[model samples]
Structure formats: structure tokens, C-alpha cells
Target chain A: MPQGKPAVVPTDGLTTRQRRNRPLVVLHTGDMKGKSTAAFGLALRGWNQGWSIGVFQFVKSAKWKVGEESAFRALGRLHEQTGEGGPVEWHKMGEGWSWTRKQGSEEDHAAAALEGWREISRRLADQRHGLYVLDEFTYPMHWGWVDVDEVVSTLRARAGNQHVVITGRYAPAALVEAADLVVEMTKVKHPMDDGQKGQRGIEW
Target chain B: MPQGKPAVVPTDGLTTRQRRNRPLVVLHTGDMKGKSTAAFGLALRGWNQGWSIGVFQFVKSAKWKVGEESAFRALGRLHEQTGEGGPVEWHKMGEGWSWTRKQGSEEDHAAAALEGWREISRRLADQRHGLYVLDEFTYPMHWGWVDVDEVVSTLRARAGNQHVVITGRYAPAALVEAADLVVEMTKVKHPMDDGQKGQRGIEW
Candidate 1:
């Protein structure tokens, strides 16, 4: 159970306490800066400390093209890592998107996104991981598209024993205030306005 | 002439009225999704008008590492689209990061980021691009790192004849509100957290 020590010796080489102290992380979603990479780094760091982890993805609706793209991209990365070469497994929980088929209206989108959040909160509370990355969890709130109260409650419930990371643009003021650490990415310069397009591998 | 017209028409394919109207777009700084790619899509939509365009990139700092990675990943895709070979040309502006000799403070990092922004904005205002993308421009603001008021004023000053895009997280609230359109990317799910590391041609 001790870190860097033989079964009998209590050398100062490493402290088991440090290893056990790795907290859970909940990553709130933001744009494609380095959230995924950062989350991966944290998870990898936790893994090194002998911690068990679980991942959950919440979305407004499964039917949206963007959702599919996000899922495929994330899975593609997962395949490269696990080297298992099988289909990426994700537990899809929540009511499907009703807004897509409904008349395109602000209300419709808001309702659907809110429903998605409730489902995600329910699922997130059920699992335990050293790090929990709530990816893109802010869009609903950012757009006034989801219920803030429900989300706050869910996060509060997981406050203990979980180092959560929430990555998203327009993070709610409340959420920002709650975070122990906050990182914001600012776009300084890029190459695309010059007529460059998104390459499959790099931009996605 | 109107759309779906014959090429030999005397008035040309586009009507005079149509030619005079150019789309207002929010472009990316360099890559797709951030600001550049988004701009490209908008430009492509406008290409039907056959409008003569200008594109400019501000070289504020040398992007040796990010550039190399982007080149390796986006080269093939760029060749296919533009019919040009090898790495995409990236503009490097601004002086690079300046660090304290003894310690690294948050302020120091912010100052460096703002220096980069100042140079980027200088370039954005001087030229006329059908669309302009200010990439990685938010670093200064996100870190509380730069003089955001200046950036906002400069951008506001240059309004018409060009569609501008501000990418990166931590976009100044002033800029976001001023933007006719703001699209934020929230990370909902990622492969990296599932033990997948960054792979070549992906996540670059």
C-alpha cells in the first residue's frame, strides 16, 4: 500500500499518502484549446498513482451531427490509446433530442439541452473516478439553454473525493467561482482566415 | 446575371447588386474550429459571389513547435485544397515570450501573451481581408494577461469591409458581446481521458 517502499522498509523514497491523495477531477467543457489533452494528462497522472477511473459524456441530443462528430473524434483518439482496435464504448443515457424534429425555435433547443443536462447529472453522480471531466457541460448554461440550479446541485453532490474539471466557454459565474483552478484560452493568432480549411486530422 | 446563369452572359454570372454585397463572417485565427476553419467555411459560402479577397496573417511570435505540429498534420489536407505542396505558410509576428530570470509568475506569462496580442491586432487593422481571424488572441486576456480594453477598442474601430473572428477561450466579454456571432466549443467528451495520448495526424 506504501509508495516506493519494500514490504518491510519505510524509506523516505516516496510517500504512499501522496499517491492516495490524488483527487478527482471534473473538467468543464470549453472550446478545442487543450481540454481533451489536459484531461488525458490528468487521467494518466491519476492512473500512475493506482487509481480507478470512469468517463461519462453528456450531450443535448444524440441526433445532432456535431454530437456524432464529437463522439467519433473522441473515440478515434481512444482507439489509438487502448490499441484494442474495437468500437469505442460509451454509455448513452438521457432522452434523445426532441428539438431537432420540432420547429426550430430557441425554446426547443433550450428544452432539449436542459433535459440532456439532467440526464448527465444523474449519470455523473452514480460513478466514481479520480478525475471526472465534464466536457462541454457549459453550453446549455452559456446559451441559457439549461437549468443552472440542477447542475449546481449535482456538482455540489460530487464535491467530496472528486477533483472535477469543467471545460467550456462562457462558464457560469457561479461555476467559475466554485472552481479551485481556472484556465481560460484566448485566441491570439491562427492560419485559417487566410482561406485554409480544416484538415481531417488536425482541426477536428 | 443571376445564379445558375450561363458563363457567357455579358453582365457576368453575378448581378451588380450581389457583387456589392459581401457576407459578414467570424473567421478563425489559423486552424478550423478555433477561428480560421470557421472563416473558411464562411468564405467558401461567399466564393459563389466571386469577390476579390485579401487575407493577412500577423506574425507576432515564432510558432516553431505548434507550427511544426500543424504542418505535419495539415500538409496533406492543405495540398488537396489549395493545390500547394508541403507545410502551410504561417505568419509569425511579435517578439516571443519573456520570462523572469528567477521565477515564473502569472503576470509574466500574461505580459508575454498580451505582447503577442498587440502585434496581432496591429496586423488585423492595417489590411483588408475578406475575412480575418485573430488566432490564439485570448491568451493575454485569459491570463488577466494583457490590456484587453485596447484590444477591444482596436477591433471595434475596424468594423466593416471585413469579417473578423476572435478565437481561443477566455475571449473578453466585450468582444463576445460585440461579435455578431459567437460559437463556443465545449468539450463534452474526449478520447485522451480514456488513456489515449495525442496521436500523429490527430489532435495536432
Candidate 2:
């Protein structure tokens, strides 16, 4: 058995392996720190499987370099040079994604986020990556910059075996309902509660 | 700022940077899939910081080759050869641990798990690694194999800045209280409920 018994078995006609092979739209949402980090962890597993990993960070502060960014960048380089693991493409709201938009063309944050979604949508259609990490992507949807219904529908209708994992708080009910795996990372304890500040290596 | 503003600032006498450098004991518990994967992800970040990583898997199923095992093994090799990232040590309940124990010399599962805990306790006393990931360690405590109070006390009294992350369901209250950060991975939705089975890559 691949895993232990399920809590509730459905009457879906598909065989166990068929059901197992289904693409997953995993949503990690809650007011906690490990959502994105867990998604990155999932990306590591997928990468081990030779899955092309693509990470799109929606809240792209230029100065906010999380530790995963550097580690994954090194992984991407390793893949490029040594053909070890799978390909990794990390795109934040930086100049590395595309240069079609002018630097001072007055492109607001919302437009840029929407454009990022568009790019991801195109990739989904083409089934570019085996695993997609939409880090902090639910914020734009929660803020109404991106349409939740459209995201749900697009992900539902995505082509091929592309597994997408989205991380952020306040995930829309529609998206949650559409997700195959939804993990609400509730905080049982946090150092911040004791007035302690976040630390490096652990927080990032 | 290492991280965004906290929900509440503490009155601790330590400065921000001082508080920031303190080690963390993170606990991932509850009925979910991504607990170990998330801990592995955190280890990746710690590895990027050049933190020596020590992962001890108490559930020593030779058949269960989790994706992170291969990925992190590659990272360990990369660090060894190229001096990139950090060093990693992975120990399972296999023969590689030591030669003191005879092969299948009537070592029951409970005794094996207890020995594993004792070894980890010794390592904690020595502050052996920058990050210690005790994968699936709670089952031993829950099953009355390893002493929960001992684990709690040992982790609390751990020296230096060694970060320890324990993941499993049925975490004892003492361990929860001793943890600096605790995440309860509640499953909002799961494909298994729909009669789907756990697959490779995602489930492993």
C-alpha cells in the first residue's frame, strides 16, 4: 500500500493507481510562517522526481531574499550544469522575468501581479513545468487583484500532469473547494507570541 | 529588517539582532501529509545558511525512500565536492547507524526506537548539528517507547543554537509546550477522501 487507509473512501470508479496519478492542486493557507516553506519543500520532492519546478512569488519585494531563493537558485544552476535533479525556474517581480514592461512606465503593482498570473496561465496551458509553486499568490486573489473564479477554473482545466501548489493566507473558498489537498497551517505556538523577534536561518 | 513587523513586540531585554540569532525548536504535528516534507524544506533553508544539518528518521522503513532523502543526499554531496551550501547527515534506523548492534539481534521495534532517541539525546547534549530534523519521532513517544518528558527536557536544555524540528501526529502536550514554533497541519481537503490513493512523488 502506498499509504495507510483513507478516512473516507469515495465511490470514484478510478483504480488506486489512476487516482494516485491525478494532478494535485495543493493549497497551503493560514496565518503561519511555514506555508510557503512547506510548498518549497514540496517543490524539493517534485524536483527529486525530475519534475520541472517553477516558483512564482507574487509579493516580490526586491530586498526580500528568502533563504529558499538562494538555495533553489543554486539547485537551478546545478540542474543546468550537471543535469542533476530537474530544471528550476524562479520568477519574482524582478527584471529577470521579462523586459516588455518599461522600468518607469508607471506599471502599478496590481497590473504587474495580473501580468504574472497571465504568464503562469500561459505556462499552465502549455504544461511547461511539472510542479508550480505559486508563493504568496493567494494574496492577490484575496485582495481582488486576481479573480478567484478564474484561478480555480484555470487550475481545474490545466493541461497534463502539472501539479500546482499555492501558498498564502485567506484562500478563497472557491479555490479551497477546488483544491485536491488543502492544508490550513494553524499556529499552535510561535516565538512572536512571547515578544521574541523572528531570527535569521529559521524565519527566512 | 530580517522579517516583517511582528504581531506584538516583546519586552525581552535582548536586542532585535540578539533575539534574531536565537535557535528555534519547531514542531509539526497533526494528521497531514506534508509534515516531514515541510521540515525537510526548513532544513534546505538552514543548509543554505551553511548550517550543518542532521536528519534522523525514526521510522526506518527501508522501502520508504522519501523524495527529500535523494534530494538532500545530492545536496550533501554537492556540499562535500563543491563546498556549496552546507553539510548534511541522514541517519535512518538501518545498518549504517553503527556496528555495536548485531544484525536483527532481537532488537524489537520499541527498543530500536528507544536507542534512536538515546542517540539523539546524546547528540543534543553535544549540539551536534545546526538543524536536527527528527522525522516521525512522535510515534515512539506516543506509543510509550521513548520517554516524552525526557525528550521535552532534553530539547529544552539543548545547548548552543542547534535547531530541532520534530514531526509526527499525536505529539505529547509536553513536547508542544516545549516547542518554539508549532504548526498543526489540518487537512481541509484531501484526495484520499474522494477514494483516491496516495501516489508517488507527491505522497512519498
Candidate 3:
């Protein structure tokens, strides 16, 4: 059954329609897996709504090809060809600050992450995408490559109705506080705890 | 960065390939949203790996149209036409046991849920799909419409490398104990807390 209206939401002034239309900032974090996967699922939903979707991979190596990238790209191509669904743009910091950057030193990775954030900030300012997924974005912030305060402020000041989702472990407290929705994926059990390894498809 | 090898996996006894190939019973449970969405994301990954994906929606109303359903169905059609990706079959219990049962009484719903589980059990016996997503399945077992003991035993006895993922809130304790991976999605904050409602695409 759907949960009842939360007590935190005041029923005094705002109309139901107004409440339904509010843009959201979602954060998915914790020690468990599926944080990025859930964010991608939201992106898939956004794409189906004909909403422009942007995916930014902060920590995954460019060489590591995740399935959502392939699937979303296919959907994006379908959109371009028949005007179906929505456009999708995926960027990886591992590829460098720009898609053309293939390899770099440790300092370069940090620099690239900052540059990636700069681009995301610009996109937020322009409201370029209806849904933005910062997959594993918490790491860069945790590593001090991106300023959490600036991120919180930029997200707070973001224009339009664009929805943003950040996924990774140990999300900064400030970001969590600023987010309209926060889901902590707690690990109750893991195969790794049983000496099992992640396989293809299941892990990627 | 990818996590190092799991210490639980004995280094001497099992080869890395053997360790990576173990099938998993994954459970996504708790109050927060995105449980089924994460399973669909895994199906996307499995599809990309050329694995047949079966999605069984156990509780969502048949009238509800989730984006992952559209996206995966499209991908399924693509596979049929061009032999790319993998085949996909999506079944909804809300539409009746076989996706054609529209409206029904309360007892009818229970019976339909049982019938759905029967089919799933058969598929598990046959090892029909590489990835089997029992979306919102916990509710049926929780309601006593489906036998949790039977479900657990059948899953344990199932053949092949098929992976099963069950998603919903209030997952039974037995199932949790049986699962190789269990993630409890805790809600830290929500827009609904501020009187915001679920929107199309994002909610479905």
C-alpha cells in the first residue's frame, strides 16, 4: 500500500498540485550496493517521460563499461532517429575532464573531477536536463576534489524544475541535509561476506 | 576504485573465475522507494550481457505503467528484430495472473498472486531466465498468499546460474536469511515529508 502523507508535510497552505510539482534533489548513499543502479533507474524513468537526461560518472574508470550506459545510449539513438523518448548525454571523469582525455595522472583525475563539477554547475544554471544523475559523485567530494558547500549552494540555487540525484557511499552531511530525498542503502548481507565475488552483469 | 578481493573468499581453494560465477539471491527491502527500480537496472545489465531477463511485478497496479517496462519491452523488441541484447518477458500480477486478468475481487487477487508465484516457481525449476526479478514479491508472502518456506526451498534447489532478485518492504525474516545480498533502504528524508507527491515517470 502507498504510504500516507508524511506528517512533516504541512497541509495548511499549499495546494496538492503545487506539492506534486516541486523539483527534487535526491541523494542515494550508504555502504550497500545498488546506489548508482537506483539512480540510473530514475534516469530511465525520466527518459521515458521525454525528459532530457544527463549522467555524470565521477569515479568509475572509462574502461569500465556499465550496462546502463549502453542501454541509455541506445534509447538516445532511438530518440534521435524517430523522435521517441528523450535525449541522453553520459560523461565520465575517467575519460578526463573532456571526453577526449583518455589517460592522466592522479592529479589529473582530481582536476578532471573539478572540471566535471564545473560543467554540471553550468548545466544546472542552464537547466539543460530534466534529470541529472551524478553517479558516485560523493567520492570526489569526500576526496576534497569538489567543494561540498559550493555543491550544496549551487543545488540550492538551481533554476527550473530539473531533478538531480547523487549516488555513492558516505555522502557529505551538507549534501544530505540539502537533499529533498535521501535513501541510505544499508547492507544487511552480502555475497562478498560469504567469499563470493561479483560477476558480470550483476556487478556492472 | 573497485574494491579489493573479498577476504571471505578463500584464496587457495577457489579460482577467481569460480568465485565470480556463483549465483546470487538478492533482496531489496525496506520503506524507501527504488527497490523494484534497482532490480530493473540489474535486468538492464543482464540484458546487455545477453542474458534472458524475466520481470515479475507482484503488487503494482496493472494500470500503472512504469518506464522500465516500456524501455525493457522496447529492448526486447529490438532483440527480436536484430538479435541484439537479450529477450525480455514482463508479467504483472495486478493485471491478473497472466497479465490479462484485469479486475477481480479480494480473494481473486490472492488467487492470482498464488498463480503468479506458481509460474515463477515453474520457471525457476526450468531455469528459464538468467535474471529473475520478483518485483514487490514480498507483499504476497507477507500476506500469506504465498508460502515463504516453499519459496525459499525452491530457490535453494533451483538449477543453473540464474540470479534472483526480490524487492519490497517488510520482507519475511526467512527470506532475508536465505538471500546472499540484502539491502535495507532507509528513508532519511523525502519530498512527501514536505507535502510533495509522486510525479509521473519518477514515481511509476
Candidate 4:
């Protein structure tokens, strides 16, 4: 698409600014690596615009955190100290965050994901953020841990100008139908095809 | 693919560390957004790893710069002040960088793009940065302004552990073939499809 120009203008009876300024529900889903990375990039953009960024990461490797977490944390600190950009809050499951999985209570991944979903739902209700990143959220919906219909309805009814971006594989049909923008990251080639192991920095 | 696991392992007779440490030529291409966004996200990861980042943007709209540039510049400043992350250098085709289009001569788009490619080539030879982001570079290749064979060979011959990421639509088949990791961002759905305009912070 051309910069700032929609291919077609709807007769939705809204002004150009109104239509442009409306919040978005962007979904990045498919079998490729850049899903979460792209979502983090959106967070960077949101931070620059002084939009409060809330990232809720779910069911990732328990071993090591992705690199974006540390970078965003630094950005958050920068915002607090110098007020250069917007505020940023990074939350990941299994990290003992206040909203993280209940310790030793929900060992099952599905239940833990469901718990995370509930926390996000509550925050959405309270209008806690301008941009919400549900990184790797599709697994729960795909695995039947989270109700797809419930998610769709909740997002549809979300209050305020909160833009939500969800990244993961197998995004539910209902959620995609309701989303404002969706990109499927498809793999054309991978270093692993040549027996190369994933590298530091680039992979994490 | 599972985290840190390859689907198939080739018999390249190299140690895991050596294979993993090898530099990658990553290409992001297709008819959707998130190409450059994903690349910038990788730059964030690279910075965290103390890898110098060099971003070269080509053929962008003159009206405004993307949000990532400002954020990266701020990160660069952070690194310079506190020895935190890594050094960052952002270069765009216009706006007159020292290596940018030499002002009066290159009136045509192709010539300017060619000049930009030459600058990147020189930087690669110098091993100037650990990670190079060729933002919207495929446009030049697709338009035949830049040579794909030369790009592939130069990247293959590049010294040191330098990772290069090229992003844009309509990537040349040869370049994709040469790339170690290639992601095609396909549009499952777009806000423009619903007659909505792109918004700041999200679109930029």
C-alpha cells in the first residue's frame, strides 16, 4: 500500500483524520521467525510516538528471554528519566511478574496461557495502555486453552484507543476476521536448511 | 520450527558453534508491511549484543522519516554516553549524508539508488558494522538499479562476522536464493482493505 493512502475510501461517514487516527488490532501470524520481532518493532514506533506500550509475552522458552525485553526495558527507563519517549512496560509469563503464572499452581501450559489471557482482558477493560502486544498469543487459542470467540468479542468491545498487536502461529479465524491488519510471515529460506544453527543476537 | 532446533541437519562437517556463529544474509520481501520493521527489530537485538548497527535506507518518501530512526539514534546516544549497548549509524539516501547521493549530479532515481548501493558496498568491504540494514533495498534490485549477482557475491565474500538484512517488496529470485534466511510478509488482511487509512506510530 502507498504511504498514508488507503487504496479505497469507505463511505463510513467519518472524517479522514478520524479514520486515520482510529486504533488498530494488528495480528502477525504464520510459520516464520519475524512475528514477535515485528511486533517489538511496532513497540519501538509506539514508544517514539509517546504511546504507552504494554507487552504481554506468553509461553516462551523458560530458558532465556528474547533480546527485545532488555532493550525495551532500557527504553522504559529512558522515558522515566528524560521523558524522551512514551512509557513502556514489559511483562512476560513465567517471569514471576505480578500477572505472571501463579507459582506452582498452574504447571500446565494451557492453564498458564489462559491465566495470562484473563490478566490481559482485565487490563484492556481498564484501558491500561495505548498499545498492547500479545506476543505468541495464538498458541493458547489454537490449543483451545483460550476461547476464540471470547477473545474476538472482548477485543471488539475494548474501550479507548488501544491498539493491540498479537504475534504467533495459527491465529484463530475469528480473531483474524476481527483484526484491522494481519500479516502472515512465510519462510522462503532458512540458514538451518544448510545445517546452520541459530546464531546469537539475530535469533534471540 | 521449534526454538533452537533445526528441522533437518546437513552434513557440513562443522562444529555447532562455528555453524551458529556464521554470519547470515537475511532477506525480507513481499507485498505487505513489517519488512523494515522486522529488520529494525533485529537491529535492537544486535545492539543489545554489543553489535554495531549500520542502517541504510533507500527510496523513502521525503515527507517524513520512519519512527525507528529516531529511536535508534537515541539508543546510539545512550551507548555513547553510558557504554550501554552498541554504536549505531543511520544513513538514508536523501537528506545528504557524506556518502549519500552527491547532491547535484544524480537527478534520476536509479542513479541515486546505484550510488546508495555503492556506499553500502564500500562499507561492507570496510567491515564498518556488525549488522547492516539495507532498508527498502529490493526496490533498487527489482528496478535493475542495483546488481543482484554483485550483491550476493559481495555479501558472500564480506569479511568478519557481518550480518546483512535487506528489506522490500519483489525481491529478486537470485538474491532470495543467495539469502540464508528469507521471510515473505504476505498480507492476510490489511486495514486499507476495510477502507481505513494508516495511522502514525503504527504505520510509520
Highest DockQ, which number? 4
**How many Å off is the CA of B99 in candidate 2?**
7.3
Residue A112 CA error for candidate 1 (Å)? 3.5
Model 3, A18-97: lDDT tens digits are 66767788999988887878888878788888999999989746544478888888788878987777899988776555
Between the candidate structures 2 and 3, which one is better when assessed by TM-score? 3
Instruction: Work out the TM-score per prediction.
Output: 0.37, 0.92, 0.93, 0.94
DockQ of each: 0.03, 0.58, 0.65, 0.70
Candidate 2 residue runs with Cα over 4 Å from true position: A62-65, A94-107, B1-3, B7-12, B62-65, B94-107
Judged by DockQ cut-offs, is candidate 3 incorrect, acceptable, medium or high?
medium
Report the Cα lDDT for residue B112, model 3. 80
- lDDT tens per residue, model 4, A1-204: 246667786999999888888889999998987888888888888899988999887775633345787778888889999998889887766664455546545567776788788988998999999999998888889989999999999999998899999989988889899998999999998888777877778888
Per-residue lDDT over A1-204 for candidate 1, one digit per residue giving the tens place of the 0 to 100 score:
001222243344545444233232343334333343334334333332333333333443433223223322333344456532222223322333332343233345556666556655654676444445455567667777776666666766763455565556677877665553444433332223222333222222
Give fnat (model 3): 0.68
Residue A65's C-alpha lDDT in candidate 1? 21
Per-residue lDDT over B93-191 for candidate 4, one digit per residue giving the tens place of the 0 to 100 score: 765444643654545778788878888889889999999999889989989989989988998899889999999888898998889999999998998
Q: List the residue pairs that clash in candidate 2.
A: A195-B10
Candidate with top TM-score is 4
State the weakest 10-residue window (summed lDDT) of model 1 chain B. B195-204
The superposed Cα distance between candidate 3 and the true structure at residue A38, in angstroms, equals 0.5
Tell me, per candidate, how large a share of the native contacts it keeps. Answer: 0.00, 0.68, 0.68, 0.74
